[model samples]
Target chain A: MANFPENIVPSEMKNFRISIDDFIEAYNKGEAELVDIRVPMETKVWQVNFGLKIPANELPKRLDELPKDKLIAVACPHTDRSNMARVYLAEQGFNVKYLVGGLLGLMERLKGGMAKDINL
Target chain B: MKEISFDDYLKSFDYDERKAMKIKLNEMLKLYEEGKAEIIDIRFKDEYEAWHLGFGKNIPLNELPNRIDELDKNKTIVTVCPHYDRAEIARLFLKLKGFNARYLTDGLLGTVDYLRGDKARDYIAKIKGES
Candidate 1:
């Protein structure tokens, strides 16, 4: 693994937070790539439309499979796991960002009526 | 083989960024009730079928990719395993692949509690009696 820039540390991760609305907007506009770090099974139960599935444990070996140049957004059931993956990807020098509220956060936003018309 | 330090083993599993979104348990409950979120039982098929949360959808970790298309991308997803570790690993993988996902912090049984509401305790008691 490579050393991360001081700004990239998750302790300093605030700069990378992306809200559910922004994520959905980007996805809709095809401006960002969504990466789901959950295992395959959970994804089969529910997931974001068009989001890619790549388990965290398998990410290291499968690094080559991802598009190196795209702006990738990572998400998990919560933020912690995805944060770790974000840190790892950042360390590996990939252009990556993580969802701020995770799926739960997104659901919360939707339920709160903040982005009801977004269609997830 | 020589022993490896826990720290070293942990290091081997290290990834680059560490950003995370914070969500409370109460919020998760509301999502479940609204039908926007699905709790997944990420255990082997046999173990999942033998016993699991009433609402948990069984999806073995290994078979996730091929079955990915079956899920509704618009919904929230929570994964559960015997322990939270496997579920966490699964969550990470799905995030990298760009799926909206999360894992039940309480593991499999915890998710049952969240799903069952106040009935969780009674459910556990009944199971204990049956066993």
Candidate 2:
């Protein structure tokens, strides 16, 4: 994760914090753009089927790779780094959101099979 | 514990009856990834704790009656066990309870085999190719 400024609060960003259920729904509908902000090593074990992996430190240089029109959702192993990414992206003029519980929450949902209906 | 005869167990359900409750692994995986189905492991609690599918809840076959309330009726329920025996029974019971349900054709062992194979790698490569 990148070193975020100490004073940057989540409220400072326009990015929305989305729940795991909503994230899965957006992913299933092909309406969400995901950015895995974890390091490369984290992906070797597991990764979402959709998304580009641009680590938080590398994001500034890789901003050109992200789609401008899509609603971007940043994810990390936990929400802290994704929250940082969200703030950064929002400042860059992109429509962005941070996954509330990040990848761990997603893995839990997958394990429990308890996510709300994707269509609903 | 005395084991029941496999032959006698086979006679418990008719051919078409058994077939209707079974779901192919590929189909279950599809529903799982698409977020349309829930994987419910019907194995013993210890067996599930030892190892089980990465996604889904575990409500052992013996405990299903008491824990049935834990399941969501809105999503398709996919029951799994080491083999299909317990899973099939669980599937039928869930269906009777008015939840859409099916059992993994060969259960957890088959699902593990499938995951261990190249299918997961192929899926990752396919996703990379598209990106």
Q: What digit string (tens of lDDT, one per residue) describes model 2 on residues A11-35?
A: 5432357888887888778777879
Q: Alpha-carbon error at B17 in model 2, in Å?
A: 5.3
Best by DockQ: 1
lDDT of 2 by residue, B3-119 (tens): 323222223333454356668988887777767888998767667788866568888666776677798777789988776545655665565555678877667888777776677
Q: Residue by residue across A3-110, what tens digits does model 1's lDDT show?
A: 122122224434555777788787666677778887767778986666678887678777787767676788887766776677677767788778887877766766
Give lDDT: candidate 1, residue B13.
Answer: 43
lDDT of 2: 0.68
List the candidate 2 regions with Cα displacement exceeding 4 Å: A1-120, B1-18, B121-131
Error of 2 at A97 (Å): 56
TM-scores of all predicted structures: 0.43, 0.42
**i-RMS values of the candidates, in order?**
14.1, 24.8
Please give the lDDT score for candidate 1: 0.62
Docking quality of model 2: it rates as incorrect
